[model samples]
Target: MSLVIDIHTHPAFFEAINADEERLHLRQTCLGLYKTGAAPLAHIFNQMKYAGIDRLGLLPLDLTTTHGVELVSNAEIHHLVSLAPEKFIGFASVDPRRKDAVEVLEYAFGELKLSGLKLHPAKQKFYPMDEGLDAVYACCLRHNKPILFHAGISLQPDAPSQYARPEHFEAVALRYPRLRMCLGHFGWPWVVETAALLLKYPNVYADTGLLYFDSAREFYQHVFTRTLGQHWVDRSLRHQVLFGSNNPRFEQIRMVEALHTLGWRASTLELVLGGNALEFLG
Candidate 1:
């Protein structure tokens, strides 16, 4: 098998949170994750070994301004990466609405050595095309860091779906053609719109972190085969698709199995699994 990478994972439930109350707070804030347990960091490594995932992108969510909390701090993510640098890729999150958002990003990219940025428009209650975020976008462009966005529906109780619609990102893509951005979860149920962005902008990408209903295989079949054409990924956007499990909400092992069962060419599978992610992270 080619090197597999799960590009969307929230490490909020790791053992770093020693207190039970803190863990409960994290679970409540991250909504729709009622059954996931806080486990030791080694548990993630074991899961990766079983799932054939060679590496993982550790994404933290900074909701300081809106939620008055950080799901997992950049410093925490940096600590995790320091423990296992070869297996973990860290991405920093900042409340773009903050006045010093650009400065925070610069420190994350330059000092913390985080690879990219992760943002959630719905949870943060901000529009993707808002002029307020131009500085954050410019900072990312200057540092050559990719931004991974939660572009579809969000499960947070206070999260508004209106903020995450795929079309809202069009302006960002058009304005910053040099900045690389990914709409995570394939932007479903707006998969077609997400695919349109992928087809139109070389700088835009999407990840297969979608597992909203049924089994992973069933959901993926419905989205990829029925919604988008069967060959759309391999033929039209092979290099732009990244495999993401959105772990704990879903399982990396099951998603990997589901993607392999889709009947895509071996080369296409390789790209979606890891090759495309490498290019996106560049």
Candidate 2:
């Protein structure tokens, strides 16, 4: 199927080299496009092509100050989006802990006109229901933008991720009924919970971005079919589940095989391929 949109990705911004070579410099400046062969893995265009993904949902991680140090900034994300307007969709990341969290959202959406937001509760050191972020949600709601939340239980240990649970988002969903919310990685361990949210809420959606092979695939299949129901596949093929290649993580073909094995209809497969993103992004 022909693909025109991809709902998730992180295209590295061109980083500036510094003499320090310390953590600060390495984390902040050692990025952007590399002069390696054709397109650099961090480059949006190249990453898109390498994964057979076209347009992308660009997520810049800026929260989790300590943990999300390598997280990209809204400024860099906006620049990349502007560089190739036809190939990318921008989503801003704001540290909900910052007093200027709402202001950050303003700059990204109100000023840059970005279409979405990436909220990482772990990196931000807050819960999805953190009162500090009420205004941030309000700002996105006021602007009518969607939010791609890095949700579900944490897979890593000693990781400072507090808002990985899918249930944490229920209040946000109930509060902002019109705000389009997508669970990155389909809420993983909480697929059943995430599936329930999708069933209960109109504004909720999921993406097939980073799920890998073997056991992970089987677990996802079981939940998608067992919990979401056999008919769930038919229902979500078009717009509910989106396709994403979490770069530097999983290959495109690997995700493709898993999605195809579900035996989805041609239209639904086409939607998961890219149609869903186009509808949401375009």
* Winner by TM-score: 1
Give per-residue CA lDDT, model 1, range 1-282, as digits (tens). Answer: 677889999887887653567656666556657766777878889999999999999998888898777778899899989989999999999999887788889999999999999999998999999999999999998999999999889876888889999999999999999999999999988999999999999999999999989998898898988889999998989999999989878767989999988879999999999999999999
lDDT, each prediction: 0.90, 0.67
Model 1 lowest lDDT segment of ten: 17-26
Deviating ranges (above 4 Å) for candidate 2? 13-47, 64-70, 155-162, 212-223, 226-228, 236-238
* Candidate 2 collision pairs: 13-32, 14-32, 15-31, 64-123, 152-164
The sequence of per-residue lDDT tens digits that candidate 2 reaches over residues 7-112 is: 7665543332112335334433333222212233255455456657667777877744545553577877777777777777888888777777788888888888
Best by lDDT: 1
RMSD after CA superposition, every candidate: 1.2, 4.4
Superposed Cα RMSD, model 1: 1.2
